[model samples]
Target: MQRKWMFTFILLVVGFMVAVQYNTVQQPSERDTRDIWAIRNELAKERKLHSELLTEVRALDETLDKYNASEEGNKGQALLETVEDLRQQAGITEQSGPGIVIDVVPSQESVAMGTPLHEISPELLTRFVNEVNRFKGLDMDIDGKRVTALSAIRDINGQTTVNGLPVTIPPFQIKILSPDIEKSEKLYNFLQSSSILDDFYLDDFILEINEPENNVKINGRSDQSENRYLKELPKGG
Candidate 1:
């Protein structure tokens, strides 16, 4: 009887020890999962806050526009306005307007609307735009209108490919204003000599401009130029 009682005690002790170990193992596992979930939640909240800050910074771009009214800025704005006016007179679509928009196409015809010789590369176009942008109020566009295009010319990739679809080209549309064709032509020659037009070897690009009008609009909108916000308020801010 004593032996049987002792045996029963040993079995009970073994079962209790197992139960304790199992419970202890489960507790740590549950705590680990909870800790991981908490960490992820905190990270998500931080990411949302970071995105909000970025949006706030971009909103300041319009409010901080203050350089468009300077003397140098006015000249650029003037040049661009002339281009647009000339383009309108020439009957080219809005795509062909003032400031500069060069589109290069690969073609044998001097006047042929040819293929894009080089594939579009974002970096290449960006450099070209930056070079042109240094001119006070110079504006740019591609295919259509622009508030401001990160790429005056665009492509899907970072590099240009020959077999790729017709990519960025120039005079894609250009409009300029001059007292006469001579003056407008002079501007075109200046652009070439300045090496501003040296990036792409496009084909059959045409330039059009109209005679200058003194009362013409100078600055079309605020975002067209690097210096677009400083114009004197027209009686009101």
Candidate 2:
């Protein structure tokens, strides 16, 4: 009876050990299943982060494109403004402001003396223009022809010409535009006391400078010919 009891107790101990081993093996499988679920969750999170990163990158690219486009547009606008300003400075555009009108006509004494209406000398006209320019004439026109820096005022075939165009005898107009009302007033005052009038009188001509008008228009230069000798220089040279 004692040996049987001992054998039974050994069998019970062996069964408990097998049961513990089996439980350990089953716990590993359950742990493996849980690990798989955790791995799937981590993968899903990584994919979501990647998708968000891609979205942010695309948004940044669109913003960069808009910024580039805006920069280009600003450059274009600045170029256009610069060109327009250059045109104004070069006197290629029409200008209007407060200024005076000068009428060159035969003097009453000369007309009464029966001196024939003769074409005013180019030298006299040039001197008059120089005087006006000295007194701050911003823009000028002789007989409706605009005078530019390159204008030629000389005699061609015994006819007085301004910018290669003939001026009508004795009653032609010279319109001058000043920068502002104050300058126009000052110019008018200077002309009133100028010696250039005496020079015109010597040439049997009368220069009549009218009062300043608020709206005086000077037309743009008619000649738009480009200089053939003016070539664009090489970059940085």
Candidate 3:
């Protein structure tokens, strides 16, 4: 009887140890599963928050656009007008109006064989450009190259150049733009009446002028440097 009781106690203790070991292993697996579930829940919450924030941002952008179109309309319009003026002044935009087109060509009959080919003088070209500017011409283009305020016309290596580019040989077009038909006509008359044409003819350069038309286009823009320098004025002197 004593032996049997000892064996039974030993079995009971072993069973209790096995149960404790099994529970210990199961507890860790359960805790790990719970941890994974908690992380998934947190990630879902963060994703939801991000989606809500994006929705709010979109709503705010829509509201701001509406405000800009309504309450801030005049300011927007003024800003647009300012931008348009700048574009016009910069010649970055294509302009079309009544203007004149002049073509300068070599008069073959006026020049004799074996004589030097009649070359257009850079000085004459410069003078003509200056005169047009003085007359408040809106735009000018030589051989499709835009003539800006800082354009340079000079003779380089026996070739007449405009802004450092050689104009193609004879019959190059010079486009001049004006604001209206009256101004265009006035400019055309000025060119015809001026002595410049007579001087050109004397030099074997044939200058041809087109009648003032309503659809002249000035499509070239300036590519000059954009750097500027300024000096501060004296305080009181």
Candidate 4:
């Protein structure tokens, strides 16, 4: 009986030691897992913070560039250039450049008929304007009236009107300003060539082209309306 009781006490002691060893090993594993998880969370946060900082740095750089461009001396020049460009495009300022003047008159043969050739058709005039525009001709005028992109060309009561002005005369003056002299000469030749002249019955019309030695003056219009859909682009776009 005494031996049995001692053996039972020994077994209880061994069981308690095993349990303590198992608990010690498992506790360290759990703690190690928790530490790795915390480290991963810290790295993720740092990555997010780095991305945010990069975005802010780029924005600040753009702001600095804009500020430098808008400095006192540079600002005035930049604004002047921008305004001049806009004025030129809008035809709000007089331009002096190398260009051509064309005088169109009704041929005697067509005038004898006195039906279709009494006055030039608005369709033909519009086609001519479109061709000149295609060749990058700037600051156009028809019979002393400014021709703009917004100008209306339509027939009214057996007569053609440009921007609501009468153009029923036998001879019409068309003035065009080109940026280059060579281009103006090319356009003049093209207008007289068979490819363009033969497109219509221009044989019933007399077209005379002349290029001035000095600069040709072109007038501007004050009635241009502002665009409604013009908007600035967003930053970084």
lDDT tens digits by residue: candidate 1, 13-77: 99999999999987765554458779999899899779878776874553235234437757667
Task: Find the number of clashing residue pairs for candidate 2.
Answer: 0
Which candidate do you rate higher for TM-score, 3 or 4?
Answer: 3
99-172 per-residue lDDT for model 2 (tens digits): 89999999999889899998889899899888887753388989888887778899899998877889888788
Question: lDDT of each model, Cα atoms only?
Answer: 0.46, 0.85, 0.78, 0.75
List ranges where model 3 is wrong by over 4 Å. 1-77, 111-119, 222-224, 228-237
Q: Which model is ahead, 1 or 4, in terms of lDDT?
A: 4
The TM-score values for the models, in the order shown, are 0.30, 0.64, 0.59, 0.57
User: Which residue pairs in model 2 clash with each other?
Assistant: none
Could you give candidate 4's per-residue lDDT for residues 1-237 as a string of tens digits?
999999999999999999999999877655545587799999998997798799879966865575577978787676676668667777777777888888777776777878465666788778878877757446788877678888888987777888777775668777888878888888777777735454445647776677543477767764555679988899989
In model 3, how large is the Cα lDDT of residue 158?
90
Segments of candidate 1 deviating more than 4 angstroms: 1-103, 107-118, 145-171, 174-187, 202-237
Candidate 4 overall lDDT versus native = 0.75
What CA RMSD would you report for each candidate?
Answer: 17.4, 31.8, 27.4, 21.6
Candidate 4, pairs of clashing residues: none
| Model 4 TM-score, 2 decimals | 0.57
Output the worst ten-in-a-row residue range by lDDT, candidate 3.
Answer: 110-119
